[model samples]
Target: MDREIAYGAIGARLETKLNETGLSRNEQAESLGISRSALATYISLERIPSASTVARAVDRFDIDPRWLLTGDERDRITRDQWVAVLSAFVELKAIMDRLFKDRIGWHQASHDDRMKVYRAGETLYEIGGISALNACANALYEGNPGAQLGAGDMLNHLFNGIGPWRA
Candidate 1:
C-alpha cells in the first residue's frame, strides 16, 4: 500500500483510539511530535504517520507502536501523555490571546470553534484571532523562539485532553 494511505489508516485508527481514550487529534499530534495538521489528516484517513511518529505514540501514549500502526486501540494513552497534551494547549492559548495581541483579529465560529475543539477551555476569542494566534503558536513552537512545548519525547502531551468546549 502507499505510504500516505498507510499513514491515513494509522491516522484513522489513532483517532479511534483517541476518542476511546478521550483525546483530541491536536493533542495526540503534539504528544507524538507531529503537527496538528498532520494529525488532522491522519484522523480523516487522509495521511500517514512516520516511524518517528509511531515511536512517539509508543513513548507518549503507551499504546504499543506496532498495534497503533496496525489499527489497534487495546491500549490506552498514558497518563503522562494526557498531561503533556493539556500543557501544550494551555501554553499555546496563553501566548495567542494574552501575549500576542498584535498578531490576531479575534473573530468567531470557524476560528473559535476549532480552537474550542482542539485547545479546550475559555470560549475562543474569535475566529481570526484564534487562527492567527494558533498559527503563531504553531510556527513558534516547532520553529522559532518561545517554543513552549519543549523538545523531548512525549511531545504530544502538549495537546491532550482538550476538546470543543464552551467557554
Candidate 2:
C-alpha cells in the first residue's frame, strides 16, 4: 500500500479505537498525552503519529502498538517475549532519561549523544515501543532476525544481545 493510503487506513482504525473507548475527544487526547488538535490531525489523516507519540499512547492507554498501527490484535505473544519487550522498554527509557537529565544539567549534549538517544527511541517505537515490543520479542524467539532490524541491531548494540541486564 502507498504510504498515504496506509496512514489513512491507520487513522480510520484509530478513530474506531477511540470511539470504542467511550471517551470524549478531549479526554482521549489527554489520556494519549497529546493535544486534541494533534489527535484530530491523526484522525483526519493529516499526519501520522510520531514514534514518541505512539510510545506515549501505548503507555497511557495500555494499547497494543501493532493493533494501533495495523489493527491486528488477536495474535498472542509468549510470556518470555513480553518480558523481553518490557526489558527493552525499560533499558531504552533509562537511556533516554539519562540523556535528558544530562542535557538539562549541561544545557546540551554532543550531537552524537543526542542522535544515539533519538535513534534508540525510534528503534523502540519501530519495535512497538512498550506496546508492541512483544511482537518483536516473539519473532526473535522464533529465530527471526529480520523483525525490524534497525531496532534489533540498536538493541543489541545498546544492551549487548538482550541477555539479563546487569546493575
lDDT of 1 by residue, 2-119 (tens): 1211324666666656676566766766677878887776677654454446546756655544345443334544545434444545654554444234433233224543454345
Residue-level lDDT tens digits of model 2 in 1-167: 10212434556777876788889999989987889998998899776665556556656655665666555555644445434445555555455446444543212545665455445544544444333333333222223334334343444344442223322
RMSD of 2: 10.8
TM-score of 1: 0.36
Would you estimate the TM-scores of all the predictions?
A: 0.36, 0.45
lDDT of 2 at 26: 99
List where candidate 1 sits over 4 angstroms from the true fold: 1-7, 72-167
